[model samples]
Target: MTIREITDLVQGEVLCGEERAGDEVACVFASDLMSDVLTLKDVDNLMLLTGLCNLQSVRTCEMSDINYMLVVRGKEVTEDMLELAEDNDMVIVRTKYSMFKTSGILYAAGLPPVY
Candidate 1:
């Protein structure tokens, strides 16, 4: 799915990288654990769905080469995180839905799990 489509499906607000809205996301890795996130080897076209709207999550994605993020529960994204993501050209979307619901919606939309 494209980031734009995913945003619509999850009723999200794009915090940055609107230029990359048409980017394709082939799978998803949902986790609040940065350690678990590091375990992911196939980062290309993968979307990270988590409630961690902080610098840690942003840094994790940068190191992992994961360029897409969907933050659940409408958590407020820090400006630091936003600036970092924008600088790295990562797309970040925020949604009012819980992680579970957001995951379900993406899965049902044909985005598969990472593992």
Candidate 2:
């Protein structure tokens, strides 16, 4: 699915990278542990949904080659995280839904699991 489709489906707020909304996302991965995400080897073109409100999450997304980062559970992302995402050329979105709920919504919309 495209990032625009995801944003429309989840009603998420686009915090940054508005120009990247047309990007395509083939899968989704939900995780709070940056270490776990870093250990994965085939995460390209995936959207990362996490409640971890830290710069590390952005780092993980960058290293994993994830195109999108969706922050769930009403968590606010720091300026550093936004900067990291911008530097990495990734889109950042925020949602008020819980992690499980957000994942479910995306899954139901045909976003397959990364694993």
Candidate 3:
């Protein structure tokens, strides 16, 4: 699904990367644990739905080559995180929904699980 569709599905705010809203993703990985993200292979075009709104999350996405990150639970998106994400060319979205609900919304919209 496209990032635009994801935002519509989860009622998310495009904190940044609005230009990338047209980008398409085939799978989703919902997690707050950066370590778990590191374990995955072939993460190209994957989108991350996480509640862990920190620099570590940005760093993890950088290292793993994940292209998108949706900060769930209405968590604050710090300037530092946005800066890092911008530097890394990552699309960052913010949502008020809980991780479970956000994942479900996207899943019901046809976003597949990374597993």
Candidate 4:
């Protein structure tokens, strides 16, 4: 699925990288642990879903080469996180749905798993 497709499906707000929403996402990873994301390898076009509202999450995304992040539970991403994401050209989004619900919706919509 593409980032634009996800936005259309979930009605998520694009925090940044609006120009890149049309970018394709081959897989999705749902986790709040930065270490888990960092440990992942050989992945491409990943859309990370998490509720860990912190700068470390952004850093993890950068190091993991994750181009997209969808934050669930309506948690607010800090300015520092956004700035860091912008520097890395990552797309960040916020949603009001819970992590499980959001993941289910995306999965049912045919988003592939990272693992």
Put down candidate 4 lDDT per residue, 1-115, tens digits, no spaces.
7888887777788999999988998989999988888888866888899999899899888888888999998788888999999999999988888899889899999998978
* Superior by lDDT: candidate 2 or candidate 4: 4
Steric clash count of candidate 2: 0
Q: Flag regions of model 1 displaced more than 4 Å.
A: none
RMSD of each: 0.6, 1.1, 0.6, 0.9
- Tens-place lDDT per residue, model 1, 44-73, is 899999998889999999999999999999
On lDDT, the stronger of 2 and 3 is 3
Better of 1 and 2 by TM-score: 1
How displaced is residue 104 in candidate 3, in Å? 0.8
Give the TM-scores of the predictions, in the order they appear: 0.98, 0.94, 0.97, 0.96
**The CA-based lDDT of model 4 is what?**
0.88
Q: Which order, best to worst by TM-score?
A: 1, 3, 4, 2
Task: Report the Cα lDDT for residue 42, model 1.
Answer: 81
lDDT, candidate 2, at 69: 89
Residue-by-residue lDDT tens digits, candidate 2, 1-115: 8887888777888888999999889888798988888877787787888999897788878777886888987788888888888988889988888888888899998889967
Instruction: Point out where model 2 deviates above 4 Å.
Output: none
Query: Where does the lowest 10-residue lDDT sum fall in candidate 2?
Result: 38-47
Question: RMSD of model 1, in Å?
Answer: 0.6
Clashing residue pairs in all predictions, respectively, total 0, 0, 0, 0
Looking at model 1, residue 81 earns an lDDT score of 95
Clashing pairs in 1: none
